[model samples]
Each structure stands twice: as C-alpha cells, then as structure tokens.
Target: MFRSRTKDGQAVTKVTEAEPQQIRDPQAPKGRPTPKRSDALAQRRTLAKPPANRKEAAKRAREARRADMQRQRQALAGGDERYLPARDQGPVRRYARDFVDAKWSVAEFFLPIAVLILILSIVPSPQFKNIAFVMWIGVIATIVIDSFAMSFRLKKGLAERFPDENRRGAVFYAFMRTLQMRRMRLPKPQVARGERP
Candidate 1:
C-alpha cells in the first residue's frame, strides 16, 4: 500500500478502482433500439426448422423455380436489358437483331421450299424428280446469294454503328436470326418489317 499527501499535508492511503457504470445523457442522440436476444434466437430457430414434410419442401422449391422462370420470361419479353441472356444482351446485339428483323430474307422461306421439293422428289417419276432437283439447286443458289448480301449489309452496318463493339460471332448471330421468319423470331422483333434500325 502507498501513502499520498493532499493539500493539508495529511497522509492518506490511495486505492485504485474500476470506473462506475456510466449514466446515459437524455439529451444525447439515441441510436436504434437494441434488439432482444429472445427475438434474435427465435428468428434463428425459425430459419433452422425444415418444412413440415418432404413433399411440402419439394412443392415450395418447385414454386420458387416457376416464379424465377416467370420473371425471366417477363424480362425477355420486355427486353429488360439487365436480365437478358448473354447472347441477346447489349445495345450492339439489339441493333443487329433489329437490323436483321426489319428486312425480308429469302432464307426465311427455305424450309418450306425444301419441304416442297422433298415431297415432289418422292413421287417416283423421273421427270418430276429431275424438276425437283433443279428447283432445289435454284433455291440453294438464291438463298446463298441473298444470305451473302444480307450478311454483308449487316456487318457493314454494325461496323458503322458500333465501331468499338466486338464483331466476332455477331455476324453469325445476325445471319441465324435473319434465317428465321420475322414473326417467329424470339425476343420478338421490336421493329416491324421495313422499319429502320
């Protein structure tokens, strides 16, 4: 123990002690109220509990999946850029799709014409089969020429519009999209046929 002298020159023993509990000032800003421990424990227990049964759990999972798909479909239909798939996202892709969709392409009719040719060739008549073969050749040539022209135009336009965008695979994407009928195209065409991009 150590002795200390005060102003009066009296000896006194000094004792060190911990600080007393602090009194909160009523005028001071009070932050958010502290949550109860019981409330926190209840929330944790509720989260830890499993569903009533396996069937119920499965049903909930299925419903969640359906909801997610529904949201995706809505986003796709609306062309909400954020939720679009990688292949269809970005302003450049949208521009390319619009450019392809706005014009008519000979390839759009290729499927039906090919089917027609097949039916004609199956008639078992040599003359008819020869005619069908010739028609098929013409169809192929026409589509090839038209597709080449369309692809050229699309590439040129994309280059002009989005000089900084990566052109790789974009041409093929536009070409494939151009092959489908305008009405049947997915992410449904934003512009009508003949509409400018």
Candidate 2:
C-alpha cells in the first residue's frame, strides 16, 4: 500500500489503498416483514363476504345504483357544478342553456302543442280533425323555422362568448332544449323569460 505524507508530517495511508466499509441503503424497506402467501390469501378471503342468494345480491346492487343516480341528479339540480355530466358541465354549455332559457321561442311551445294535436286528431268530430291537421302543419313549419333561427343565433352567441371552447354539439344541445316546454327544462331554468344572459 502507498503511503502519503500529510501537512503535519505523519505518514497516512492513501484512501485508494484502504478497504471499503459497507453502507446500508437509506431507501431499503424496514419493519414488519411481508406475510406468507397463505396468510395473504386468507386475509383477502375474509375481507369480503359472498351473498347467500342471487336475488338478494341483485337487489342490493340495484339499490346502490339507484342511490348513486339520485345523488347525481340532486347534485346537478343544486348547481354543484363539479358533479354535472360531461356534456353539461362547461361554462359554454351553461351559457348556452341560460341564453335559451332566457328567451321565448315558438319551439318552446312545441311539446304541449304536439300533444294537443295528437289528441285533437283522435277526436270523433270532423271539425277537430281538420283543426288538428292544420295545427300540425303550422306547428311543424313554425318549429322548423324557429329551430333554424335559434340554432343560428345560438352558434353565433357561443362563438362570441366562448371563442376558445369546443362547441361541437352546443348548437344541437340548445336546439333540443328549445324544443321542450320552458317549464319542463331539466336543470331547471336559472333565468326567467326575457332575462338577459
């Protein structure tokens, strides 16, 4: 082994000539050892109990799903925005809904009129039948024209308001909402008729 003289004049062995000492790794796992395979299997087996009957298991599962849906609907209705469905959660969609809900449209009356027309068409009176026929044509024509106009305005508004947003289905969504009677709109109207968005 080579020796080197230190500044104090005493000879010291070079670090390269000394044997290295073992050092423990700081990241090494410590504490309780892993369980045996049999022990692990036993633990897993005990964690969950199997249902005794298929019908009971199914009923329990159905109840769980029902509860989940109810919670989701409540969250949406309460405007807990985080829990809203993918299509309805974003600011652009919310704005579109508000825009449509704020205005009055012929399409908004479509559902009730369509139902009335169906009832009128089935009546025994020829007068009712003729009225229903004329009404149906008028309703269809009015809805078609109004839907076009609503969709055009809605698309333009969404573009102006949310230029960075992906508005792929926003127009269709607004159009569908317009087709429903105002009072029956889901996630019910936040703004009253004639209110500005």
Candidate 3:
C-alpha cells in the first residue's frame, strides 16, 4: 500500500494487486503412467532394422499368419462363424450357406465327374475321347442351368426373408458355396440334406 493524494488533498492508502490463481481443468489424466523408451522400443519388434532382422520379422509374420489360418480352418470345420473370413461373416452369408448346404447341387459333382472325364479323354481310343468331351460339355451345361435356378430361388428367398438387408453378392456367394463339396465347404453345413433353410 502507498500513500496517495485525494481530490480533497488528503493522504490515502491503496491495496497492492493479488497474484492470479491457476484454474484446474475438469478432465482426468490417463490411468496409466508414461511408458519408458526402452519398453516401448522392445514392444515394436517389426520396426525396420538390418537385412537379417527383416528376414526374421517376415518369418515371424508368416508364423503368425499360419497359426491364424489354422485357427480359421478349425472354426470353419466346426461351423463357428466368429473366426470366419469376412466373405463368410454375416447373417445373409449364413443363410445362403444353409440354403446351399440343404440341397444337393450338380456343381458339387462337377469335380469328380470332371476328373473321370479327364481320364477318359486321355485314353488311346478316339471313341472314348469323343464320349468324354461330350460328357464334359453336358456336365458343364447342367451345372450352369442348376446354378441359375439356385440363384433365382436364393434371390427370391432373400427378398422374402430380408427385405431390408443387403443382398448384394449373396447369390454369387451361395452359388459358389453350392459348387464346393459339402465336406470341403468353409463354415461347414449346419443343416443336413432335406432340412429347410
């Protein structure tokens, strides 16, 4: 405080300014403490390094991918959709799988019949080769017709059951599933033949 002159010519005292207080924020800090540099570096094993380190990193990646693939394969065989690849991951895809699995497809017999035809075509006799060629063409035509029928039915069923759901690629997905052998199908058949999907 200091003495000052007023308008009345009197000595007066004034108060000094007080220090400003820091304001506290309402936000809370992170629950964990900051990590040390060494610990952070140790966690990043795939960071760029020497040529040998790069090769080792790639090997590690392969091993991880192999393990993941095996796990997915087991999941597929067990009909567990949780670990399935993206293409097989949704209600629509599942419905398509069930629909295809419940029905026998001419496309499924395609592989075995094709192999038989291949063998027949390799025979020395011209008659067998001609027969095999005709068989192959017939089998392919049958598969094409069957695929179209299945696609139409699947599209109709999807439209009826899932009017609002995304149906894009669903017909193709079901058709491809129909082509695969039942035992070899991924996200294996949950429904038996004669069961309605």
lDDT of each: 0.83, 0.83, 0.87
Deviation of model 2 at 64, angstroms: 6.3
lDDT of each residue in 1-197, candidate 3, tens digit only: 56899999998877667744566675867645779999778657545453377777688789779989997998788867778998888889989999999998999988999999999999999999999999989999999999999999999999999999998999999988877888988887999998999
| Worst-scoring 10-residue span by lDDT in model 1 | 13-22
Per-residue CA lDDT of model 2 for 105-180, tens digit only, reads 8988887888899999899999999999999999889889888888888888888988988988888888888888
Q: Residue 73 of model 3: what lDDT?
A: 93
Which ranges in model 2 have alpha carbons more than 4 Å from their true place?
A: 1-67
lDDT value, candidate 3, whole model: 0.87
Listing every candidate in turn, what is its Cα RMSD in Å to the true structure after a full C-alpha superposition?
13.8, 13.2, 13.4
Model 1: colliding residue pairs = none
Ranking by lDDT: 3, 2, 1
TM-score of each: 0.67, 0.64, 0.66
